[model samples]
Target chain A: MPDTAFADPDAGLSPAELAARHGLGFAGTRPTLGGYARQLWAYRHFIVAYSNARVSASFSLTRLGRLWQVLTPLTNAAVYYLIFGVVLATRHSTPNFIAYLCTGLFIFVFTQTVAQAGVASITGNMGLIRALHFPRACLPIAIALIELQNIGASMLVLTGIVLLTGEPLTWEWLLIFPALALQMIFNTGLGMFLARLGSKMTDLKQVIPFVMRTWMYGSGVFYASSLFAEHLPRWAAVIVEANPMLVYIELIRHAMLENVKLSSTLPHLWLLAVVWALVVFVGGYVYFWRGEQEYGRG
Target chain B: MGVAEVAERPAEAGQRIPTVIVDDVHVVYRVQGPGTPGSGSPVAALSRMLTGKRTPGLREVHAIKGVSFTAYRGEAIGLIGSNGSGKSTILRAIAGLLPIEKGGLYTAGQPSLLGVNAALMNDLSGERNVELGCLAMGMSKADAKKNSPSIIEFSGINERGDFASLPMRTYSSGMAARLRFAIAAAKKHDVLLIDEALATGDARFRKRSEARVRELRAEAGTVFLVSHNNQSIIDTCERAIWLESGEIRGDGPTADVIKEYQQYMNRK
Candidate 1:
């Protein structure tokens, strides 16, 4: 037997040391940030494909097919207009009420859908997480992409409504590109952050819709956010103006409407948009990456 | 041959590069259920509340006891165990799908787990799923697009009709399982852990998949197949590990370990 006990080569070393010596890495440990970014980059195509698949699959069973994508938000805008515009008579406070409402609704809906999807991304795709070896961030990233496409559809309807409401097309309207891009980044980050949280406490999934509704109410999606200064305390209005959803909505409103005025306290909407995108995206990504190995475990 | 000899024998035959090294790994699952103490009845809940006992329904299950093994390149190993014996749990641990509470699992490359019930996207078409699966496995867009047709063809889902166009939910379970195995097998993995995916396929598909597994081994990949079908194990794997109650009972040549497992089961 050649003295089996003495012959055992790795007997003296701890498992971690043994693995290190043999050039084996701890299988489920999170990769370094650069390495993780590279992995995410490599799977970029997967993100696109998965998001596309999800978008198509969502409406594949319906007779209207992808038209539901536009119809959903259109119907939602109509219902909100009926209640908030007709019933509450809030239209007198805002200029070009239809354009303003649609812009805010579309922008707020973008974040709302992204948040809801992000929260469910990990918990909803347990099978995919357990089956394949990939970056778990892909789920939320894909969710973000799906919502971007949804917003793209909604933007078309928003543009048509704005033009119908007699808002002129101008050079400033091109700012929508940067504004949308920043919002996408912010939404993606938030989704990723929520994906990790949702995977841990699936109960959060049930509570998310109510939270989103409350967020929408506070975001000035229907009523003018300027009214906050007139109604609420100065600190509260400033806090509400600083909300990420409000920042994004205000940015989109500025891009699409000529008459919409920038918030006086935070005249730099673009600056806030950029800062929110960078902070949330980086923070949410790290949070999600920290829980990389825990996503699929029971 | 002895257990040590079995692992070393392959080293002598080939390079014996270790692909997966699982060292004394432990996994515990904290599950909440109705049967757990102070969970079901209102009186129990009240008493537990009065006592301030946290997580009333939570029960800790030591799913994988301290288990250790090493898998080498170019080897096909079968894990034979009765239900609840931690076969799937160990596989998930190696695949990095589950967290380990103790010890360590080290691998040279990513370990992909092919479980029977892992439906990628039930509402997406099978063809779309193949593309997405390839992309998800880190294949580039062009490569995924290029290889998807062949993968779908390999699964034989389109043999009867253009079934690949239909949503995965429309396919039979066996068809879906076959498609999943085909997508997984299309990629060359350093360590592939399969959990009863083959048993869902027909006999002809099983034979084809077994042959594909050998080809994967020949490509210097380590494949661990967990199945109740001993004959498949005997045909596909040279080494087998017999597990019972979260611990390894026998580990050696397929025939020897399987014989021991059979003897133990029959005795019971």
Candidate 2:
């Protein structure tokens, strides 16, 4: 046999160099941002398939199945309307109160569901994470898509409610599409951010419902955005008006209702909505990706 | 072949390319102690929450400490260790499922870990789960559809007549594990890590899986089988590494390593 000792001695090279020379990659090193994006893009079909399967399985045990997607939110709106619109009489100050409450409740519930699902996405799928290797972001993104699907189903009911409330369809109605798209982006970003946080701190899941309830009250889901300006201090009113959910709610209301009033002091709601979506989407995405190597680890 | 002849042969004779090079890798698990302090009554939980003092006692377990090994393409290596010897941790680290605490682990391609428990969902039907499992492994829908028949046949779950149409919860543990192996082994992998997947199956199924593993190795894929069954290791692997308490105790020809390991175990 040829002398094995003198054959290609890699004695001088470092382990990384040796790995590079031999076409091997260092394990546990985070993929580059572009590479990660490419991997995620390649798994787009998987994300869609997972989202569809989860949506179908979510309501399988119930007799109504997928119908609950629309009914659950509609029923929630009905209860809130009974308490706030009739009992509490917040509707006296608001125009087209049915449309207004439905829009706000649907929009707030969309974000609320997205946030809760995002928190559970990682913790719930520890089995898949530990078993197979794929993009961990797929879990949160798929959860977001499930919420998106639910909102898509709920939007039909919302449109019918707006029409039944004697609101004439104007050119402003076309703006609802962009408004919903922006909110979806915002919800996706928030979901990803919360997923990372929830994975690290399991206690966050326990606190999210309380946090979301306070957020809903602050978002003016049951009342008009103008109510916040009239009743609250300037700082609190500014905070309420700047809430992304309120911005989305107002945008949707402006789109669907011809006579819906918006706060004059809340400057450029459209621009603020776009900026909020971008900030949360990009910020939450990067934050989640930074912890990509840490998920499913003990 | 005799031990002398086995030692005389080059370990990398047919497959000169090293598919995996685990260089002095380390893995540590941080386990939370029971003194977490806030799990009492709701009043105490609220008080502790308000004080912002939620620090729990922490314990660090150095699971794998400085494990180094090189695996060549077409070589099936068995990792034999006692309980808590970090065998599964090493396999998981190579599969890129676990983060390494220190040192370098290099692999030529994706290392797919064969875990029967993780892929199949209980609530979904077996057919649906097969499709999802294939999709989860990055298979396109069309490919998953085309492979479904052979996957079903390979798993032999169809012998029960409409069992594939039933929910996976109705499957026995052996059936579930068999289906899991079938799904994992269906796809060609560059580095496949099997962690006791064959242990749950019967003798016939184990033989079939061993043959599939050999086929994978023949395809120039490096296979790492972690098992407590020494006979399976000796039968399937040409090389073996014995681990004891987070360290490599022996590494050589499978029979040689097995002999030493058996002796050490019997003496204990």
Candidate 3:
């Protein structure tokens, strides 16, 4: 044996003293909140590049390539239109139901995709997480960005469809940008929150689709908010109307269609939209960062 | 050298600053039943989901059971062990990739693991992956762009004609490993962990990588190389740590530790 002489030479010193002397501290220690924010900001370029690459690579294998971004949602709208409009005769009850349905489908899918992708962000990038060290939030943020890009592409198709459905190009249509932007912030927050949650409970992956489906139904994606007020209990009606997704979907529909009537029960939709966006964005971000050191662990 | 000569050696010979201090660190992996979802029926899974009770049977795998070591700057340490002996786990723990279940690890700077397989995307072209890898390692876009040519040249993938332009999935395993090693080696790290990065390289490439590791160490960095190839360990490292079943069997000069490890392996 070589005497093992160097073993624990700093045994006599306190941890703080040892840290000061050797320029070391506990490994995997969570950075300070401000430091964490700075580190994340430094990685902004990587997040953007990663999101762009994944968005482009996502469709590379398909023949339609990037066109699928637009086509997938349109196809979904057509399927819902056939079932809800023709089979269920929902269009007879709601005026300009094609435009209304398309707006709802396009907007709802944007949030849905963001949530789903966010849940998978950490679980999907296990290889990268296990191999390299960076802010784990980057994965979820990148997923949200990918959804944002996809929604941006799909919006072009949405604009054309709204025009085809006889909704005039009024200045109110400009409100769509703010509506989408608010939803983006809301979705990004939800994505960050879910990313941390999904990393801990793999079972969340199985439950998300069902949860999103219920959320879609409650958000009045295929129907009007008035249906809830007319049929459901008073408390249930408030829950449906207060849902942030419904607020966004209603906002977009109002922006796109000049004749679409706003329900009397829905109050202060714009203010609620902004408040929900800010609350979720800040809350989810902090919630996700709190678990930063716990991610990628067995 | 005898034990006395080794003992007389200065503890802080080349560089006095301790780059890595792993103080009685332990890492446990909670492997869910059989590493897959249980064979329960979909109805059972659904019922469990509905009840919000997702309790999978848990088993703890103690990958590193209280390993302690201090690595100083300008030192290259070799970690040698049989399969699943926790060599890679230790490197990962030091890199902060694995959470230490007990004790603590302190480091001077972020430890970079030397393997591109985790950082680079297979669907991306090698050229794009190089740029992305550089950016992921904290290099600015301009620096990544400027360094791409040299990274490609160092990896030697382009020698085969347009390999850099091809998607990484098209490359052979060796080609991929070489490219990954090149990308990681392109930037200087304060602490570098090499987990079998040299195992896939050819003889010439391995020699080049060995020289590069030495160059890195000479620049006042600590390096931990986990490799099964004993010769590479002996050649590239001055000290060797022999671990068996998540415990260090021996730690000393490279030749002495390797000799003890080889004997232990032969007896097995």
Give the alpha carbon lDDT tens digit for every residue of B1-268 in model 1. 2444464444543445667877888998877566664477888867877998865566789999988877777778999989999999999889898889998889987888999977688888898999988888888888888898889888999989999999999999999999999999999888889999999999989989999999998888889999999999999998888788888887778988888888889999
* Candidate 2, A1-298: lDDT as tens digits: 1011111455455566767878998776788888888888878877887888787677767899898988988898789888888888887787878788889889899999999989988888878898988888998999889988888888999988888988887887888899999999999999999999998887799999999999988887776778778888999888778888889988888888877678643358998899999999999989999999988676
lDDT of 3 by residue, A1-298 (tens): 2133343556566444665687786778999878988998998888888897797677767888888888887898889989999999898888889888888888899899888889888878878898888888888889888988878877888888889988799898888899989999999999999999988887798889999999998888888767887999898777777789999999988888876766433358998899999999999999998998877675
If you score just chain A, what TM-score does every candidate get? Answer: 0.93, 0.93, 0.93
Write down the lDDT of every candidate, Cα atoms only. Answer: 0.85, 0.83, 0.83
lDDT of 2 by residue, B1-268 (tens): 1222123225463325667887788899876545546555577668767998664545688999888767776778899978999988899899898888998999987889996556556767788888888888888889989999899888888886989988787899999999999989999999999999999888888999999999998888999999889999989898888788888877768988788888888999
Backbone clashes in candidate 3 total 0
Model 2 reproduces a share of the real contacts of 0.56
Output the number of the lDDT-best candidate: 1
Q: DockQ of every model listed?
A: 0.55, 0.47, 0.51
What's the C-alpha lDDT at position A265 in model 3? 33
Retained true contacts (fraction), each candidate: 0.66, 0.56, 0.51
Could you tell me the TM-score of candidate 2? 0.92
- lDDT per residue as tens, model 1, A180-212: 999999999999999999987766898999999
lDDT of 2 at B40: 54
